[model samples]
Target: MADTKTLAEIEQRIAILRDNLRELVEQAAGFSGAANEELTADRINEQQAELDELLKKRDAMTKS
Candidate 1:
């Protein structure tokens, strides 16, 4: 079973990831060029994957 501290840490990480994802989305939306747009899109995808993983981990911890 996970301790309270561990759960809190996971929740904090999730919050950070959510913030990062928001920032990435905003940046992607603000872009008007072509060269850097691909890079920004890739980064958004990566952040989304990371956020999804963290959410899964948090769910698992809570279920235990």
Candidate 2:
């Protein structure tokens, strides 16, 4: 079970992750190399996974 403080912290992290993904996509759009695109895609995937996990955790916490 998570306390209110923990839930708030999770929410904050989720927001930050979303901002990071948006910025990464914008930067990727400007880059022209295949290697840069691949690297950016990998980073986006990792961040997306993290955001998904946090979203799940937040849902579970709220349901409890």
Expressed as tens digits, the lDDT of each residue in 1-64 for candidate 1 is 8688988987898888889888888888889788779888888888789889878888888889
| Per-candidate clashes, comma-separated | 0, 0
Per-candidate Cα lDDT values, in order, are 0.85, 0.97
- Return the lDDT, model 2, position 1: 63
Which number leads on TM-score? 2
lDDT for position 19 in model 1: 91
RMSD of each: 1.2, 1.1
Best-performing candidate as measured by lDDT? 2
Candidate 2 wrong stretches, greater than 4 Å: none
Across residues 1-64, which tens digit of lDDT does each residue of candidate 2 receive? 6699999999999999999999999999999999999999999999999999999999999999
